[model samples]
Structures are given as C-alpha cells and as structure tokens.
Target: MKFLGALDDVSLGRTQRCNRRLTDPNRLQAIRDTGLMDTPREEAFDRLAHLAAELLHVPLTIISLVDANKQFFKADFGLPSPFSETRELPIDASLCRYTLEGESIISSNALADPFLKFHPSTGPWGIVAIIVLPLINPEGHVLGTFCCIEPKVREWTAQELKVMRELTASIMTEINLRNQITKLKTEQNLRDTFVAALTHDLRTPLTASKLSLQLLGRRHPDMPSVQTSVARVNQSLDRAERMIQNLLDASQIQAGKHVALKLSECDLHAITVQTLEELTAVYTDRFVLKAEGTFQLMADPIGLRRIVENLASNAAKYGAPGTPIEVVLGRSGAQVTLQVKNQGNPILGEDLKNIFEPFHRSRSATESAEKGWGLGLPLVRGFAEAHGGRASVTSSAEEGTCFTITLPLDARARAQTRLELLTSDRVAPASDVSVSTRE
Candidate 1:
C-alpha cells in the first residue's frame, strides 16, 4: 500500500474548483429526492455497512449521503463513543466528496497522500487507509457513498473493492424501494379520506329520504298533508344530490383541477333570503336572517346558495335546541361577509382548528342526536374559496360559535388562488337539518 498526503495539502484554488465540481445542482436534487438523508439507521443499511467492514477487514464503515452543506451518515459501524454519536460532518471536511465527484477513491496510505493526509479523519482520527464507492442511482446521479475506513495503513486488493461496490448497489435499491412505499402510502391515505367523506355524508340525506317515503306510504290517499310529504321527500333528494356534487368538487380540487363556476352579477341578499326561507319551510322558524348594506356580487348563485345552506343547516343541528340561529350578511370595504352564529356548546380549541377538514367531526358534534359525515364544513369552505374568498370560524364559551365567510365583490379574479389553498388537511365549519328539519 502507498501512503498519500492529507487533503488539506491541496492548494486553496484547486480545492475550491473541486468543491464546485462536486456540488452539481441536478445531482444534489437527486440526493434529496431519494429521501434518505438523516433517516433513522435502518437494520437493512446497517447490515450492508457491517458486511463491508467485515469483508474488507476494516475497523469502520459508513453509508453516507453528501448533502449541500453536510455529509450525513445513514449507517455507521465501529466508531468510538463521541464520533459514533455524530450524525453529520461539514462537506468541506468530508473524504466522501471525492467519491461523489463520480468514481471510487481508494488510499492505502493516508498520512503520505497529499489530499488524504490533510483530511480530518486521517490527521486527527488516525485513519491510515480508506476506500469510498459512489452510490449511483439508475438515473446515473451519484447520491452518496459507501466506504470502509482503516486506522492503520493496509494493502487495497481487487476483491475488497468489488465487494464494497456490490454492497453500494444493494443500499441504493433499498433506498429506492423505501421511497416508493412512502409515496404509495401517501396516495392511499388520500383515497381513504375521500371514501370516508363520501360514504358518511351520503347517509344523512339518504336516511331522510327513506323516512319521508315511509311516512307517505302510511298516510291515506285523502290525507290533507299528502302534498307536504312529497315536498319533504323532494328536499331530501335534492340535499343528497348536492352532497354528491360537493364530494365530486372536493375530489377535483384534490386532483389539482379547478372548481367550475358560473360567474354573473347576482343578488347576495336574495340568495341568503331564499336559503333561509327554504330552511323555514323544512325546519319551521329556527333561522333568522339579518342583512345590512348592499349584498350584490359577481358570483355563482348556486355556489353561494350552497355555502349559505350548509352553514345554516350546520348551525341548526349543532346549536342549542330552541335558540335562534342568526345568518348575518354585511359588507366591509370591497368584501362581503356572511356570518352564521349559533349558541350552543363552544367547539373545543383542537376541534375548532380542524373543523373544516374533510370528514372531521368534533366530539360534541358526533355525540349529538344529529350525526354527520363531517364534509359539510369542508364543502362550505370549498365553495366559498371557489368564489375567490375565505371562510373562518371563532368559537368560545361566552361567544358561542360563529363561522364567517368573506368574499370579494368580484370573485373571478381570485378563483385560481382559492383553488390552490383547498388542501386535504384543511377543516371548516358546516350546518345540518332534518325532516322536522328543526334542530
């Protein structure tokens, strides 16, 4: 074995040039994409590093990735107490940088080699020999290095280098497989969330429609309220259809698709008034509408109506029984604010934060007589945002609960921004109603 001088012996200009060449932007990005840096030491990787040390007859081995600023050890074997506790080292001090520059670097005599002798590991740690093999991905990017270190100078043989290269390939395969599994699990979670929301929300309206039809069947053909029963059945069917549409829109949003809107000059006041009137017909007079200032905006009438309907319905179901639900529509500056206030048990702090998330129902809500799938608030937020606006809620013991939506006078311009913010993790407040449609 021939000894080489330390890495620090290299001239400043040459070292800077080498550093620049090693930090390829695309190569660095590929390293990040592997999702391997700073990960917990896995037994699979540990076994490979152990095998390298054993086969090469060396005291230390490391499976490391050279990040932009640091060389991170994914697995390490045969290191002293304080060094074993270390997870990373600065890039400039890393011998692995040589392997990352695109080939295996082997030095049997570090104290005599110019670059190797000056390296921190060689000088202070007394590492006399080292062999580093690049862990190259299928795309031909050098992600990191697998290396063996010796405290005493030793001869480097062909078989030892071959074994280390083979182990590097195995390490890369495991990393790629782990990343794929992580991605698949993420996608599966999204699908499960969508399914849960759909199944739960559909049940509410379906049960209402079924009960209405059963009541109509028991009534005589000459019954005076026969027409009223038919109306109630129609309302249930309509609600069910709306629920399906909202779910579809939510899916579209998740898929990075836009929520289609029919924009036109519409009377916000009329929409609120009509929505409240419909609720009165179904649930008696538990809702009150208070309008101040002009409530006209360029918006999708149906979307606006759905937003109000969901909020009002949520207030009725969750508010204190016999307490009035207030629907307030007012204008501030160029924005119109629609607030649904209900007096009941205030939402818990944690639950309030996640209320608008799809398929999320607070403990209080789930315990109530009226059960829901937890999509109402999410849909309300989706519709509100689709109109280039935002929906928020405030709840406390003294103030009860209030869900407020503020929309721009012209929503078309901000439509794209709204779509971008509707992520799966977001939760919003919602409303509900039953045949007595009264809470």
Candidate 2:
C-alpha cells in the first residue's frame, strides 16, 4: 500500500535515462498493442475516471497513456478546454510521464516541486497537489498513470491512496483485457483471410471443369451414356462450386466486410424463377412460385440469384417431404419484397436467436447431417444487406417459417452513398494520426 514511499531518482529497466525510456520502442509498441492511445474515449474508461475523481474528491482525474512524444487521455473527468479538445499534451507538459519511471507519485506541494512548479498545471491551469499511480502492465512496462489533481494542496489520506491503487489496478486490467481482445480479433481475421483465399483458389479449377463438361456434352450429342455421366459430373461440380462461394462469402461478411457485387439492371422475377428451376434438379417438383409480375430493379443479377438459391435450398432442407416451398416477389413504393416460405417444423426459439449468423446451424439441422446449408442463411442475409436491403425470418407451429427480404428499387444510389461515406472516413490527413482511429 505504501507504493508512494519514494518519489526520486529511478533506473528505467533498460533505456538508461528517463526521457529516453519514455520513448522506448518496445514500450511504444506495447502501448499501440493496447490501442487505448489516440482512440476515442470509451464510456468504460470515462466511468472509471469519474469514480476516481469523486472518491478521491479531486477536481481533475485523467486516465492517461504516455506515447512517444505525448500523453494521450483515454478518459478525463475535468480536463480544461483546448486540452479537452486535443486529448493530448506534449511529453514535457505531462506529469504522467514522470510516473512511468516506475513508481506512484504524491506531490503534496506542486508549487515547491521542481517538476510540477514548471508545468502549466501548477500555473494558469490552477492545479497544485497531485497524486499519480503508474499504470504498469503484467510485462512490468509502465504505460502511463491514473492521475488525480487538486486546486489546493491537501493532506494525503491512507484511505484515498489505497482507493487510488485499487482503481489503477482495475485500469491496468482493462487495458490488458482490451489488448488481448484485439490480438484475438487479429488472429480471427488472419484465419478468415486464409479461408477466403483457399476458397477462391478452389473455384479456379472448379470453373475449368465446368467449362470442360459443357464442351463435352455439346460435342457428343449422339451418345446418351456420355451425356448422362457428363451431366452428373457437371451437377456435382456446380454444387462444389456453390459451396466454395458460400465459404468465401461467409468468410468475408463474418469479418464485417461486404461481398463484392456487380450491380446492374436485373429482372428479379427472372432470377427467382431461374434459380428455382435449377434447384428442382435436386429438390424435385417442390418449389412453388406465388407471384405474377415483371419486378425489375437495379441489382446484382448474380447476387439476386444467390439470394433465391440459398432461401429455396434452405426451405427444401427443412420442409416436410413433398411439401411445396413458396416463393413470392413483389414491389411496394420504391422497394421490392421477396419472400421464401416453407411448411416445416417451427424453428425452435433458441435456434431463431442466431439462425442467420454465419456458420450457425440449428441442433436439429446438425442432427440431420445435411451439408452446404450451413452457410446458406448467412449468405442470404449478407447478399441482402450488401444491396442496401434487409433479411428477416419468422417461424411458428401454425404459420410455418418464412424468410423475407426488402430492397430499394435502385440500389445504385444507396451503394454510392455508402461508398462515399466509407471513403470519406478513411481520408484522414497524415499529420492527424488519431483522426482515422477516432472514426
């Protein structure tokens, strides 16, 4: 509890000098790995700052992380203007950096202290007494401080010092916890990237086989046996190719990235009917279309095809044998609606919770040993959203299960607007290193 036993000369582990150690490359990397520096203040850190300020009865409290040349405020309770907007101060202006030499500091008289008497905090900033607990990680690197400042000098209370130490421990936990999460996410992204690349490479050979099968059937019109074998091979290849694309699309969208689209003026009715007909090759005469309209709109034809294929395919897997899977498409206002419903066992309430989540399959579905449908719903949802549309589902014992989608009549405008927004956010100036992270 007496971490404030000494407030003088220090050896900085390896960097030899205090200022040099403040800018140590390894410490800077550790700070970056935490990602608290230069990022927008989060409520979790802000609440900690407020709690410390209130408990310690101090006018100002900052959860500061020292960087190479400045101290960045992860959260602050009473930081004054200019500094409040900037969220950072040069290393010379940072009393927090002095704490990074590896000890907590409690300066009872800032006006008399060599370091505090020179900083603006003791001058026009009006802060006199200060208590700073160095935020050290498990690696024993002092990242920064949980600082409390007072306008008037006050006696140091053991209770207040204990509370500060405890809260700083909590702050260190949060920093390391967040850093671990970021590292895990980075690992997940790397894995997803590998899956995407593998699936993509797989499709190249699948495509060649498909084309070769097409030429084989075309050239041997008189041979029925050859044609039948060629047809079956082509079908298997098509299914394999579709599965590969599903894996690729699921991988991309799971990482919060969109599936690339080739948008154009496409016939929704035609896409739906064509996809259903192709699906009939496997599901047989089970799909029933329930609309009569031209339903044309600006969309990605291939994307539209996948939407119908995934939904109908999903319906077939879950629907009772010989039951008709219903597909309905229509337009209202400047929006288009497409629905695929099936008469099947009502989806369990628990399964409905994450039914559309990528790679998720219900327990019942898993029990059936069905394949390919694993990523269908997510692809259905992702393709729907990529076109500025939304996909949803409802299931009931009496009403059956229905999946619905709504899309803008012209996705071009919505897609363009989104692209502009994403691009504009990325155009942060080089000198403003934090702006991109803030966005």
Candidate 3:
C-alpha cells in the first residue's frame, strides 16, 4: 500500500504538494461561498453522513469543509468528544485537507501507517483506520472531503472506495441544488414584495384623486379652495400616470420591444423647470435648479417629462426633509445631460447594482420615511436607454446620491435607424407576411 510520503515532510516542518493545493485561494473561496463554515450541523448533510457510515461500515463520518484557517465538520456523524461539540479543527490538524488534491486517500491503519501514526485524530482520539474522498465542486475547486473513520484497523475494499466517491459527488450535488433553490426563493420573495407594494401604491394615489374630485363636485368651481383641490387631484393622477407608464414600458421591454417613443424637438432645461414647477404644489420650496445654457434635444416630451418627474419625485421622497433636491442641466458635445442630486443616507455598494432593476428597493429605501413603488428608477433607465441615452448614478455620504441621464442631441435618428433595420430584416413570403405584420 502507498503511504503518505508528504506527512514525513510536514512532521519536519516542510511544505508539501498537498499543502500547496490545500491552501489554494480558489479552494478557500469555494468553501467560503458555500456558507457552511462554522454553521450548525444540518440534517440533510447528517443523513448523507449516516448513509456513508452505513455503506462504508465506519464508526465515524464527516462532511467536512476546509478553509484557510480551519476545517469545519458540517456533518459530524458519530464524532466523539471535543470534536462533536466544537465541530472544527485547525487546518494543519485536519486529515481531510490532504485529500483536497487527490481523488481519494485510504489508510488501512492510521496508527500503523508510516506517516499518519503521529496524527492527533488517530494517535490520541482512537480513530485509526480512515478513508477520505475529496468534495470537488462543478467548478473543479476541491472544497473539502467526505471522510469515514474507524478505531480498528481495516482495509477498504474497491466497492467501499466506489461508495465514498459517489457520496462525495452527492455532497456537491446537494450543495448546488440547495443554492439554486435559495436563489429561486429569494427571487420569489422579491416578486411577492413588489406586487404587494405596487397594489398599495396604485391605490393610494387613485383614492386621493377620487376624494379630491368628489370635493370639487360639491364645491363651486370659482371657490378659492377648488383650485387647490384640482391641483391635488392632478398631482395624484400624475403620480398614478407615471407608475402606469413605467409598468407598461416594463412589459414592452420584457416582450423584446423597445419603448416606442414619439420623438420631437424639445428643450431639456425647459422640461426640468416645468416638471419642478408642477411638483412645487406638492414639494413646495424643496427643489433648486441650475441651468447654464439651452439644452435642446430631439426626444419624446412625455418620456423626458416622465424621466424628470420620476427622478425629481424620487429625490423628494428619499432626500432628507426640507433639504434641496438640486437639478443641473447642460449640453456636452452633441448630447444633453441632466443631473438630479439629493441629500440622504447614501446607497450601499451592494444594493447599487440592482437599484434600477424593476421592483428593486434598496435597504435604505425600505428604511426611508417614504415607501416607493420601486418603478421610478427602472422607468428612468427604460426611457433613457430607449432614447439612445443612458442613465447612471453615484451615491456617497459626503456628496449625496445623484442620478444622471445623458441623451443624444438627435435621438429621432436612432428610432429611424431601428425602424429601417426592422423593415429591411423582415422580407417574407405572402403567407408569412401577415404573421410578420403582427409584430
């Protein structure tokens, strides 16, 4: 039988080939990513360990995860004493680490083996015979081992070795399946939250608008208070309109279609000024605008207005109360840029990546004074992208959160180009012509 020659070097304090693979950064990262390190023993892994012990006819079994600092017994089946309670061992003391770069390591008698005789688990803990199968993930990184240990000397059969290998593969399969299910569950929870918030958001504005209209019906049109009620209803409807448009645009984009825009010559600076003016009745004295030059661009007025409304409204909602929501408009080369900056708790780096996704509300957003529909930023992105432009954001505690939209000076040309491309790509036979038109 082959003995572990590297163990001799380890006793004399020399780095061996197995140690090189054992401390690999990628291998360590795979173990970390599993989220199993130092966690409580789980029944699923325990059951697998039990099955391994039964199949391999061993007194102890372990589903181990090796990291740089330690080896955790994720499934500590029948392990005795300090180990059963602690479920971990220092990396150098862990026998499982040696199997990381090998298919399997079988020791007939740990106490009699030339190199393993001095190992603690064997020499002191009465665990003598041992077999270890490395658990390599689909990405080819060896995480740790599925090990079976016994107190008495025993030679592992070919069939027992095969069983250990199959069990090790099952461990990785279980990990992958568990991770996929967790991902699906998280997405499902997010969808459920989005639906719940969307319903409440849609109902609030409509209910307010209805109440305002009812008030106007009883009050005389010439009454001073009637104008205020009308403005209130308009603002409520505008909010509802933006939400609805965003939803529809999301659907269109999902259907593999661009947000069809009606592009025309419009002043971006004028749109920002007007949007702020309209919002003044709601967020009075809350907005500050700085415009240095004429920022005219060929774009959809309603789309651009929706962009301004969504961004400015978002700022008002998330910004600190009574703090100014600043708007800056300027032309850079042949494109116009609009920046809306607000002061509030900065967005977290992790949450920023998914901030513009439909139905994504950041942790800061959830904790803010205002609860939003989660459609505003996504809508802002949809319109900006559909108009041959892009939307980007930056957030920091010192400078505040700012969303910038950069749109080409002539976006109508983009729509025209897309239309031409579609027309040229769709030459079909007479029978297929009708189906083509349906697009």
The numbered model that scores best in TM-score is 2
How well does candidate 1 score on lDDT at residue 257?
Answer: 42
Q: Kindly provide the TM-score of model 3 when superposed on the true structure, using C-alpha atoms.
A: 0.49
- Compared with the true structure, all predictions reach lDDT values of 0.77, 0.80, 0.77
Weakest 10 consecutive residues, lDDT, candidate 3?
430-439
TM-score, each model? 0.53, 0.70, 0.49
Candidate 3 runs further than 4 Å off? 1-219, 254-256, 421-439
lDDT (10s digit) by residue, model 1, range 1-439:
1223333444334456546756688888888777777788888989998888888778899888987788888898886666568788877677777665476778898777766665565677667888888888777777878888888878898887788878888998898897788777688578757756776778676777777676775676667587667766666676777667777766655544445677778889999898899888766799888887897788888789888988998898888988999899889899999999999999987898999887789999999998787878887787777776899999988998999999999775665344334433342211110011111
Put down candidate 3 lDDT per residue, 288-371, tens digits, no spaces.
898887887778888899899989988888887889999988887998888999998888777888888877899978987777
Locate the minimum summed-lDDT window of 10 residues in model 2: 430-439
Off-target runs (Cα >4 Å) in candidate 2 are 1-32, 35-130, 138-142, 148-153, 157-185, 211-221, 427-439
How much RMSD separates candidate 3 from the native structure? 15.7
- Between candidates 2 and 3, the one scoring higher on TM-score is 2
Preferred candidate (TM-score higher): 1 or 3: 1
Candidate 2, residues 161-219, lDDT tens digits: the string is 88989998899888889888888788877988799689878988998988988899999
